[model samples]
Target: MSSSRAAVAGWALAACVYLLAQLHRTSLGVAGLLAEQRFGIDAGQLSLFVFLQIGVYAAMQIPTGVLVDRYGPRRVLVAAATIMGGAQLVFALVPLYPVALLARAALGFGDALTFVSVLRFAATHFSPRRYPVLVALTGMTGTVGNVAATLPLALLLRHVGWAPSFLGAGALSLVAGGAVALLLPDSTPPPRAVRTAAELRSGVLSIRGRVRRAWALPGTRLGFWTHFTSMSTGTALAVLWGTPYLVTAVGFSTAGAGAVLMVGVIAAAVVSPVLGWLIGERPSVRVPIGFGLSIVVVLGLVLLVTAFGDTPPAGPVVVFFVLAALGGPVSMAAFALARDYNHARSLGTASGVVNVGGFVATVLIALGIGWVLDLQGGTTARSLRWALLVAVAVQGFGVVRMIVWWLRVRATALHRQQRGEPVPVSVVRRRFDLRVTGPTGESGPGD
Candidate 1:
């Protein structure tokens, strides 16, 4: 097979691993009521489950990145799939609440490895020009997993009971793992000179310095904040609370809520390619597009919160959900941004730093909503409405931070360009219609 074909096949298999990760992460949302019934947990305890899962996932990002850098994506992906499968199997069978909590924590640790590995693998194999679209496509594939978590998983839980349903989900992971082990191409890292034992130890001790350096890059910080502002609302809603809110607050039946969430996933999938193309063709618009989508998200939340006390009309509710779904695509620009700012060697670490932003926001918002709902004493429409206000507030804070960072980074890049230092082509803003000669003196589009 051609190298490009091999890369595509390997990436597809890796994306399958990501699909399962998404399913595992979001599966709890669909199973929330079932989990509460089985474990006899209240709102606070249920939120604890989500909190631990997301918290562990967030905590593991940097380590997972370092491991990927050291061991390569093939090993990391295979191990991730195995661990997630085992965790899900334990979650399916465990009778005690504590055991179930441990199972989710294990799942989170494994889930953390999939996305960055897949992204790192893509960065290794693909050209820089194609990275944005590839990232978006990878995200779009994961949305399918999210959709499956909704209707299909819900139906399985209804008919086969929770244990059988989750057992089947676990089995899928093992199958994906086996495929990755057998078929995924292991890319060899570029050769490095052998170092003395003392040198290796010094390198290990200086890991913090490396991370600090990556974090200092304006583009890296911009990517982090971009992810932070773009994905928090969607992640919080889709992964933990969207279904419950729709069912309890919007007056939809369980199936009705599942259908709506599924629609939102579909909407995200549809728009992802467009967003990717826009970013790829005109990198200058990356921040603007994310900023615009965030504004729409804030507006949607405002409208939803305002209409919450009275039953919200279905049209407005559906539109709000669709806007929420757009977050995933917009946040994906962060990966491209990270790629532009860092070298391939530190791409994993930079990506990890960028990845942390959304989930951290997600953890806070999900927990905050649960706390608010608990404070109000029930999951009624009024309580859920007030709880959703937390999302609006969090999103507003993110937008402000994003604007501040965007201006800072843009100015830094413009100044650096004025000084004649080479910057990544993607970071250099240019007109859409500008034509420039390449190094070979062939005229074409310019950044």
Candidate 2:
């Protein structure tokens, strides 16, 4: 196959691996009640499962990114698939709660590998112009897994029982691992010259400093807060608390809650391509677009908290969920921003750093909700409302951080332009007058 074909084939397999990762990540949401019954745990213990999983996932991000950069996606993705597959199977068969928690941690560690690797694959294989759409598509496809975790997994748990349903999911993951191992073509990194042993030791010692440098870049920091501000609310909802909140708090039936959560996932999936196209066409507006989306999300959260507090009627609640879901697509702009700001050598590291934002927020928000519920002594509508307020507060903080970073980056870009240095296309000033001529006395593309 041609290189382009090979890259496409490789990414297709990677996307499948990502699908399974998301499925494993969100599986607990639908299974919360079943988990509580089977493991004899309360809301706090149930939240611990996701908290531990996401914590491990968050902790593994930098290391996994380093591995992906050093080795490439094939090795990392294959290993991730195998570990997650095995972890899920163990989660299914194990009866002990402690053992189950270990399985979740393992799953989280494995899950961490899939997303950044898939992103690295896209970055390595595709043209820069194509990347925004590809990134959005990757996110959209992963939400299919989230949808599966909802109604389908719930139905399977109800009919086939927990062990068999999870065992089947695990088996599917193993098959996906095999496919990735066999079919995924690794990206070639720039060649490195042989170095002295002393030099190698010095390099190892400076790895932390190098990471710090990557974080210092304005674009990478922008990416981080972009992901931070845009993704956490929906992620916190979809991956752990949304279903329970709907059922236990808002009083939806199991199936009804699942359907509502499914709508949010589906809405995100549907909106992603449009956002991708818009970002591709007007890269300069990326931050503004993200800010707009964040505003919408904040509005939705405020409405949910103030208007729908305890007994939310379904229609307005669905609209609020859809608005929250739209944030996922908007967050894809962060990866594009990261790509523009960083070099290829550290792309994986930058991506890893950017990827951490949302999950970190999600972990804190999920755990906070659980803690609040525990303090309230049970899952009541009022307690759930209070828990959701935690999400609102966190999101509000993120929006402020995003705005601050965006201003800093924009100023830096302007300063660089003033010095006559080449900068990213997105930051260039556009001339609105169609008749305006460049120094060459001809209309430029910007005109």
Candidate 3:
């Protein structure tokens, strides 16, 4: 392949891994009640199926990043796909809940291995100028996976039965892994200072030390909080709650609920490139835009439930899903922040830390909502509405912290500029005011 074609092929295959990550991540949302029916589990246990996968995915981020550094993306990518496919096959045939849980856990492991490796891999393949748009598209590709897992997967389940559907899913995963192996262009690891990574792997540098060092940057934390507030609620909704709540609580037909989810994913796909361009054109807007998105989405959802109760009007509910899906693209700003502020060598760890924010939110809040549903004796209109309110509360809390960290990042940027440092200055919009912030901690490149 020509170099450009090779880059595209590699990126495309890597994106396939991410696509599966999102597919499995959101599979249970469509499949949740079915899984419950098959396993005879309650809401809380059903939540465990989704939440545990995410919890494991979140917990693996930093470690997976380290492994990508210590080993390489190829090994990690191949292993991840194999594990995911095999686990899904196991999940398809399993008759026991505990075994299913173990299968989901393995799936999470494979899912966790993907994006970091993909990001690190992309860093090696593409020029820095293309990075922002590429990151956004990565998220968009995952949303496409979400689309497939929705109505298509739902239809497959109806037509083919559970085991056959998932068997096909497993087979697809294995095929994707094989394609990646054959097509992704080989590249040398990007050069970077290895002392920190070397010691970190050898246990000379503690995991806490590396994590604390990365998190110590106010910009990194800003990215974390930005994603924490903006991303996960949409993810939580998409993962296990949106379809059920829409159908059972808001009087959406099953097809209507599936269409709503497909709408969200498609909307996210459309927005990702626009958001990526904004971030690339004006770095300052990264955090500010994320802040704005979180506030608007949280307020919109809050108003929807509070005003309409369980029987929200369809038109407004459609607006809510569009707004919520927009958050997925906005959250990509966190990666831009991590790329902007951290050194290239440290990018993997910082990215992993940044990556954890949303899924952590996804894990805790999804699990909490499941418990709340269980406590209320299932997905009643009242129970589902209350559960979503709980999600808003968490999102609201993240926005509060985002404000705190946003201010600190701005201050840190101003301080660096005053000290005769090289920072990419950009205009930040504040209430009735304009201010300055900084990024491109490196001269010509960013994450």
Q: For each of the candidates, give the backbone clash count.
A: 0, 0, 1
| Predicted candidate 3 versus true structure: per-residue lDDT over 1-447, tens digit per residue | 233876877888888888987887788878877888899998889889877799899999888877776566776788888889999999999999999999999999899999888887777677666788889889889888899888888888888889998888888888888887777665546545557766547664565677777888877888888888998788888888888888877787666787888888898999899888888887777877888888888888788778987778788888887788788889988888887777777677888899899999888788999899999998788888888877788899999998887766665555455556656764233463324455423231212
**CA lDDT, candidate 3, residue 164:** 94
Give the TM-score comparing model 2 with the true structure, all chains together. Answer: 0.91
lDDT of 3: 0.81
lDDT of each: 0.83, 0.82, 0.81
Q: Candidate 2: where is the Cα deviation over 4 Å?
A: 1-3, 189-203, 426-447
> Model 1, which residues run further than 4 Å from truth?
1-3, 189-203, 308-310, 422-447
TM-score of each: 0.92, 0.91, 0.91
Q: Which tens-of-lDDT digit does each residue in 37-86 have in candidate 2?
A: 89999889989998999989988887777778887888899999999999
Provide the lDDT at 344 for model 3. Answer: 75
For model 1, residues 304-384, the per-residue Cα lDDT tens digits are: 877555567778888888888889988999888888777788889889989998888898889998889889896777887
Q: Which sections of candidate 3 miss by over 4 Å? A: 1-3, 188-201, 204-208, 427-447
